[model samples]
Each structure stands twice: as structure tokens, then as C-alpha cells.
Target: MDTGLVGDRRWQEKIFTGEWRDGGGGVLPVIEPATGAELGVAGKAAPDDVARSVARADEAQAAWAAAPFSERAGVLRRAAELWTEHSAEVRTWLVREAGSVRRKAMRELGGTVAECWEAAALPSHPLGEVLPSERATLSMTRRTPVGVVGVIAPFNLPLKLAFRSVAPALALGNAVVLKPDPRTPVSGGVALARVFEEAGLPPGVLHVLPGGADVGAALVVQPAVRAVSFTGSSRAGHAVAELCARHSTRVHLELGGNSALIVMPDADLDRAVAAASYGAFYHQGQGCIVVGRHLVHDSVYDTYAQMLAEKAAGLTVGNPAEQDVALGPLIDAHQRDSVDALVTGSVEAGAKPLTGGTYQGLFYRPTVLADTGPGAPAYDAEVFGPVASVTRFSTADEAVELASDSPYGLALSILTADVTAGLEMAAAIPTGLAHINDQTIADDAHAPFGGLGESGNASRFGGPAANIEAYTDTRWITVHSAIPSY
Candidate 1:
């Protein structure tokens, strides 16, 4: 199945010019989510390809590190502009390759590009000012960039998360090596590399490398790589943490979550159902911050369940390319099997499915389960599919208690009319981030993103500031040469 010569309009191979490609083998299939059909074959770097990539990265990074922050940041701005210009084509590939819905994909891709542009403008943003002391002239300290960063993203939100990492890393003048998920290795669309190349970055400053765990591990463990930015399941994230920890490597991991959303007694049922449903089903609930536990205050539980079930019923589940599709298939047969098994195990263990537990092709019905034991896989495991485990609590204190009962704490939503109660509950949730008056996940690019406990470690706040902060090591410049102001 030779797709013939690779054309500018289509990509045949994922490029690797850094040490990530040093040990090189060759290409592997990358499937289109819509049909489970092959879209393109991505290069899987061999041990040697990986070595060469590192060598290139190490060789290329010193100059990038030496480049002026202003000049480096300008490249990110140009890339953002190019991303915006190519939104349509990017969305097309996203819809086909990743099974992302057209409208949602468009918005997310656009937002991702916008954030990258904003990252480029950050060096000029104000921090704080201090008047110098005359005796020996003391001045305020600033920031600097790490030499290189390993930027990785999962298949579900590939471009967005990759942008969350690479844009900031570039802005901070850290040369980057990107490892996109092997499942959806469209490399954030064809023009992604072109955008940066046009943005005027020095050759090798930014490189795209896509592969599986072996490739990722090689990059993370490489001495030339200074930091890692990753998003995936808690189990996988733990492995990343351990590997990096063993070598004292720095990391920012967005790991697995079975996040709980507390909709209090005072919250409107209309809003609560919308939040829970959207939070649970968007991206097929593959999101790390998906609302897996729907902990409603007892006063509104029945109505909330009804609205939720009705909403779930209306979400058209099918192949992504179909005109009527609302929710598409999971990423692959493995995810399909996992979702089905989790739902079946929950049912066998005594949970009741409100409306769904159906599976077809890669599609798992938007499932709603209630009354499962706290320890059952449905409630206990990170259900990376469209399933919700409903639990009721009588008070705000009870809500927090139940929500925090699980060891995972990535992100949680607190929906309530009482602003005071919302803030109070938000403060008590124990998770890294909490949302109020909102059902779905909402992360500002400027705020830190990561988790604690089983949810993983390394807080990655995406944006120019977080970009510089995460990648750079700060050391005070103590000018000891000052002829003592005696």
C-alpha cells in the first residue's frame, strides 16, 4: 500500500532530525479514527534513531539556549499566526485522524493556536519592578530557559496538549523534541512544522518526533533532555514519574483521574445536568479531568439523574464522519474493550445502568451507572470512556468527603449557586484545580495544570510565564567582584 511519493498536501513520514532519530528504524501505521482505517504511517525511531535525535538535540540546543529571548519568542508568534491561517485544514485532519467532532475540534485548534501566539508575547509582559540600592547596586532577579525539553501528548487532545507544551517551551528558548501519540500522529496537521520553520527558528531548535513508550522513555532518559511535559493515564504517568525520578529528571505530568463533580442542593438542576453530561461525554470521556464521579447533593439527585439520562440518550453515538454523529468511537479496540469490561464489571458488581452499556465497533454507549460499590472498577478505576458513576451526598462537607475519598486528585468541578459555598468547597477539595458554576473542565493557559496522589505529579501551567518557569532553572547572580562598597 504505497501511497506513492509523499506530497506537500499529504504526509507520509513523521520527521525526526534530533537525537530522537539517532537509532532509527522506520515507519508504522497511524490510523484514522473515523473508519479505523490507516491514514498514514509514522516513523518509529529505533534505538539508534533515538540516539541520533539526542545528539542532534544536544548539538542544536546550545545555540538555541544562547539566542536572545526576544528573538526566540518572535518565532512562536509567527507559528501561532500560521496555525490560525491553517485552521480549516488542521480541523479536517483532526476530525478524520483523531475522531474529534468538527465544531469542537475547530474551536480547540483555534484556541491552541491563539495560546501559542500569546506565549510568544509573554517576555515583554510585566512582572515586578524594584529600585536599585546604590551602595553595591542590588537589582531584582528574572528568569532563563532550560536547554531542551521532551514534549509529549496523548491521542485524545493531541494538538492542544502539544501546543500547551511546545509553544511555551519555544517561547522560553528551550529547544524542543515532540513525541506525539502513535495513534494520531498527524503532527498537528501538515503545516505544523512549516509554521515553525516560517516563524524563523534556527534549524533543529524545534523537532517533531512521534513514537510509542520505547521512544518516549529514550527521550525522557536522555541526558541532553532537561525536562518532560506529558499528559496521559495515571498509571502511565506514574511510570514516567518513576523513570525521571530515578535520574532526578524534571517533569510535568497530567495523569489519570476519576474526578468528582459536586453539584450542591442550591445548584440549578438544568445547569448541573448539562455540566455532568458534557463533562462525562466530551472526547468520549477520555479526558484526564472528565467528571467520572457525579456526586450530587441528595436534594437534587433524582432530577439530576433524569436530566442526565435524557441528555445521554440524545448524544448521537456513531462514526465521526457521519453527519449525525455526536459522540464517535473510542480510540481503538483496546479502549473499546476496556470500556465494555469496566461497564460489565460494574453491572456484575451491582451498579445499575440508567440508559446504556451498549458496545459496537469502537463505540461504547454513553453509559450511566449508579449505586456501584466505592471499590468497584467502575467507580475506582479511571474509566477512560463515556461512563458516569453517580453518588449522592447530603451536605457540602459530605460532598468534599466523598469526592476526596478516592486517592486520585487531578481536577474537580463544584457547581453551585452559592458563591460563598462554592469557594469554601473549592478550598476543601484537595485537588489541584476546582471549577465553580461550571460542569465541564476549564483550564486557563496561565494556571498550573497537573495532579497529586494517583493523579500524577509535575504542575504544568501552559503559557509564556509557566513556559519559562517550568523549563528554566533559576540561580541568583551574586556579583562577588564588586569592590566592597567600603
Candidate 2:
């Protein structure tokens, strides 16, 4: 099988109807953020391509859905095996195409492999429950696939998010049309299709269309597409939701976050510093659940801030393929500019930089901001970069109030030795995922992962339970014995 990364022309083909074809949306250049060089060009899918892809997926849904659970599971397991076989190639693409550091690329590839295998188990997951009936009857509920699902993934962590949605949708016997960010299509989008195709996924059960917002909008409004799973900025997520609403389609969004890491007076300073540093700087702080705010208690705030600043300053920012580089370039110059603007605005608004507030090309330094006020952009908005805004609180109520003061309720972390205090603090916070004595960005394949409020639309996208919910619809049935009277 062709890996599809052979040349510029080969990269310009869309995965549609089980084969590659040059899409109508013309050619888009793929840039490597680390060096600001053109990696290659990818084919962009037009609106017509979107319609055709969805139509094909619609046609293929029934037969795929009718296939036995064991068969579907076998395909998914084979896909996982394929991922393992191609891990090195995928990791290289991630590093070059998406600006992911070696460690981050490895982690994402590993997670994608695990997610596929976990999705394979979705077929064996319980569908629904049997309920007692008032009369001499039996009542039970069952789940069915929601038909063709449209997945729109962002460039950051492209491979992981695409499979995070696509794998489960396929596991539940639903066809999928995935639109990956054009910038990282080869790494994020096409590679996925290669895996499934090699694993013998039926034609049209999975399609990859690489393009911009036009393709995504077309997918969202396609009549055959019953559901949408999106992961990206809150602004884009809201737009996707609104478009899906017009079609009366269900959408599961994993949007932006300004998660906070709270440090209590009795917290272990070393552990808190390490967790905060990793949470805020990992993946160049590009993750949605990154710890953007560090709320330290007044008692140890100065010491903690000092240690965090030292750690942030010591991080190596360079080419992603380098061995010792901890931070890589942002996805593009636009994102780097945005991060710079936010940092500059915060500093102008009375926030002081404790460690870093500089950039070279698309690479932004790991920054720690001190004395950030409520009105500062760094404190109020999602920076989506390697910048941690620190503020001090005197009491637990103040900590909770500060932590819960964001429009994004994605995730939060409470670091304290006392489990009781951590639990109490966790209960008070309004975020979706709360961690005691750990960072906010940790995810397990078996747990439900999503957010509340502006972070998402109450849709979970991890584990078998979430897959069952997102990819299937519940139907309740009742049967009366001996035709009992109503």
C-alpha cells in the first residue's frame, strides 16, 4: 500500500470513495512551523467533495452497521496494529507537519493506538438497560448507530483527536467523514485513512477530506451527516454548533479552556511546581485542558512562583525533532502572534513577567506571568501558548472563586497533601474534570473526557460509555405478554 507521502502530487489527493483523488478546492501548501519551511502541498476539498463524501458514507452505513460486533472489533484491532507498525512514520509527520516535539509526538501516537483498541471494545459495551413494567410486559432499551458522523479536527494533536472521534463512531457501526485541518492533513488526516484501509475498513465507511472552514461548514450542513464531533477554539466550536443546529444535527464539541491549578498553603511545593510546569508548558501549552492559571495560596505563593519561574526559564525551546527540546514552535505564525499579543497585553495591564515573554519566529518562550489582574488578557482569556498566569489567594473561598471565574469550565486541578481538602475544593469548582494532587490535562482512555458550560455541549468523547452515547441513539421497546389490556 502507498503511504501517500511520496511526493507533492500524491499529498494533493483526497481520501474519498475508498481512493485518492485531487479535490476541487485547489492546492494548499503545508508549512513546517519549526523552520518556517514548506513541507509540501495538500489537496483541498471543495463543497462538492464534502457532499459526495457524505453521500458515500450514507450509502455505506447500513452494511457496515449490519456487520457483526466481532468483525468490527477485529477491524479496529487491526487498525491498532497498523498504527504500531507505522509509529515511526506517524511520529515523524507529527513532528514535521504539526510542530510537535519528539516526546509529544510519541505520546500522541501512543494515545491514538490505545484509543483504537479501546474503541474496538465499544461493540461489546452495554447498549441500554431492561426496566420493570407496570403491566405484565417487558421493557428494554437498545442503542443504534447515528448514521454518518462528521469529524472536524484541529491541527494541534491532529492524529489523536481525529481517531478519538472517528474510531468510536466506526466502532458503533457508523460511517464517518473526517475533515482535518488542511495544514496537517498528512499527519492528522490521511494517515488515519491509511491505517483503516490497511485494516480492511469497507469503502466509504471512513473518508478523509482535507480543507479549510468551507469544507467543514459543508460537512456540518450535509443532510446525510447525522452527528458532528469537533475539537478546536471556542470561537470555531460555537460556529460549528450553530451550523449543526440549523440542520438539527447532534454535535459533540471539545472546545477551549482556561483551566486553573490551585495550590493550597499545605500543598507540596515541589509536586505543585512540577505539575504546574508540565501542565502549562507541555505541547507548548497548545492543549485545550492546559493549566493557564496558577492560583497559589498567599502563604507559599512567593516560593512557588520562584520555583515555577526557574523551571519555566530552564525549558529548552527548539526544533521538535531535537532530542532535548522540551517546547516546539506553535502551529503557525498567526498563533504565535496571538500568544505574543496576549502576553504583551497582560504585561501592559500591570502583569509582570517573572521568567519569559519573548519569541523568535513561531517559537515562543515558556513564560510565567506574575501580578496578573482580573482584567488582563492572559488572566481572562485562553492564551493557548506556553504562558502561565499566576495570582495569589488568601482563603479557600477566594481560591474557588478565582478558579471558577472563567467562561470555560473545562478542567481544574487542586494540589494539596490533604485529600479531604482537595476533594472539598474539587467539589466547589465548576469545571468538568477535576484532579486532586495532579495536573488538569491528564486523560485516561477508560474515563469520560469533556467539559461543561462554554467548554463543550455536555458531550463526552472517551471510553466506551461516551462512545455509546455520542455515536448511537437509544430506543425503548415494550412487549406485552399474551396481549394484556392497556
- The window of 10 residues in a row where model 1 has the poorest summed lDDT is 1-10
TM-score, model 1 to reference: 0.92
TM-score of each: 0.92, 0.96
lDDT of 1: 0.75
* Model 1 C-alpha lDDT per residue in residues 349-386, reported as the tens digit of each score: 88888988997778778988877648668888888899
The worst-scoring run of ten residues by lDDT in candidate 2 lies at: 1-10
Give the alpha-carbon lDDT of every model.
Answer: 0.75, 0.88
Q: What is candidate 2's local distance difference test score?
A: 0.88
lDDT tens digits by residue: candidate 2, 1-486? 234333334445444557877798887787888887886676778999999888888999999999998999999999999889878878888998899999889999999998998999998888888998777778999899999999999998999989899999999999999999988988888788778877999988998898889989999999889999999999999999999999999999999999999999988899889989999998999999999999999999899989999999999999977665999999888888999999999999999899999998888999999988589999999999999999999999999999989999999999988999889988988888999999987777778889888899764787777889899999999977687555
Give stretches of model 2 more than 4 Å off. 1-11, 480-486
Off by over 4 Å in 1: 1-11, 18-23, 125-142, 188-191, 480-486
